[model samples]
Target: MTETTENKDLVQEENVVTEETVEEQAELTVEEQYEAQIAELQAKLDDEENRHLRLRADFDNLRRRQQLDREAAEKYRAQSLLTDLLPVLDNFERALQVETTSEETASIVKGIEMVYRSLIEATEREGLQVIQAEGQPFDPNVHQAVMQEQDSEKEAGTVVRELQKGYLLKDRVLRPSMVSVNE
Candidate 1:
């Protein structure tokens, strides 16, 4: 009877130890699951933050590009009107070249000259400038070589004569001067 009682006590102690070990394993598993979930949530949050930063940078670049475009448009606002009036200005120049024989013709010529001067003044105020080509070095940017000539008096690559005038609006070339270059 003493042996039987000792055996029963030992079995009870073993059962308690097994239960405690199983409970400890269960708690450990639950903690591991929570840690994994926290890691996953942290990764997702970091990804979202990166995406937001990229979107903000792109938006800022777009806004800057649009502002530059607006400023350029404003700067060249009168370009089209000035371009359209260039042919009329050419006609006025041609009309002024006519030789007047009589007093009546001279008066008409003087009136045309006054009108031409006014037109030139108005165009100048709007940033129109005549490009000087004659006796200067030939430049493809502001002068177009319509014909090349061999001249003993001028240096090679110099502009011998300007056939038609060129105009500029601010720093932009409206038309290149038609010129003869010495070669």
Candidate 2:
């Protein structure tokens, strides 16, 4: 062959050999393709693990909310009962209003006093309490000042009298007390 034709053939052969060498050294067959697929599966597994952790955290928060609701239900179970007992307390006050000293009336009064004491004790156990209003400092959040009186003995702005009692239920104010403040 001519020298130019021989050189062209050699160039073509070299190009083909270079392409074959590149393919042989790559190690890119079905097995290496499986490795890439396995890497993708591993990434999916990591994502699933992250989603599982998020689900677990959400479950924990739901459990805490349920626990709080149950505790609140248990703690406030006495509220309805105490609301029903308020009229009975009013009746007791009406009985105290009668200033009679007959022996029979006195016995009835004593019996009513014992029952009242038992009721107060039971209410205390149930978290119902009477707010201390006599001689306490005036607190607008907890006490309603119904009267103001001049007092030289107690400090100014101090409560001198209480017209009604207030109560609290577990750090929450259920009622405010009516009181008289010293000017």
Candidate 3:
């Protein structure tokens, strides 16, 4: 064969090999692109799932908080009405504490006592309870210490006397007991 023809044939053979290599590389590139797309889609799905979980948890927390608020509202619903009746109840108590001078006054006092007892019973039925302060330990939560007295018999921080009665509505304190504490 002539030198030019031989060189041309060799060049054609190299071109065929290069074409085959390029085809193989194209196939690999297509597969790699599909894999990359799948990975990206999976990551997106995972992110969406995480976001959904977070939103669900937030909604659940909001629901629980609302439920607690509703329960508290229901629990303290009678707070204002009961607070208004406290002064009337105190007056009844004061009247019952007075001494009677004569039989006439004693009968009137007895009638007043009956009315006071009935009122107390009615309040008790409605969950009004007098807070025990006298002779008990002075607690800032249930007792308002208005005066301090030095007493040798009682320990310090002990309740010596209750000046004005305090009350509770259920487990909540409607009024703290006005009391004198031993210092």
Query: Tens digits of per-residue lDDT for model 3 on 41-100?
Result: 999999999999999999999999999999988877878888999999888788878899
Worst 10 residues of 3 by lDDT: 118-127
Model 2 worst lDDT window (10 residues):
164-173
User: Clash number for every model?
Assistant: 0, 0, 0
Scored by lDDT, model 1 comes in at: 0.94
17-82, model 1: which lDDT tens digit per residue? 989999999999999999999999999999999999999999999999999999888877888998
The residue-by-residue lDDT of candidate 2 on 59-89, one tens digit each, is: 9999999999999999998888886776677
RMSD of each: 2.3, 3.2, 2.4
- TM-score: which candidate is best? 1
Please give the lDDT score at residue 38 for candidate 2. Answer: 99
Off by over 4 Å in 2: 1-12, 21-42
Count: clashes, candidate 1:
0
* Per-model TM against the reference: 0.85, 0.79, 0.85
Alpha carbon lDDT of each predicted model: 0.94, 0.85, 0.93
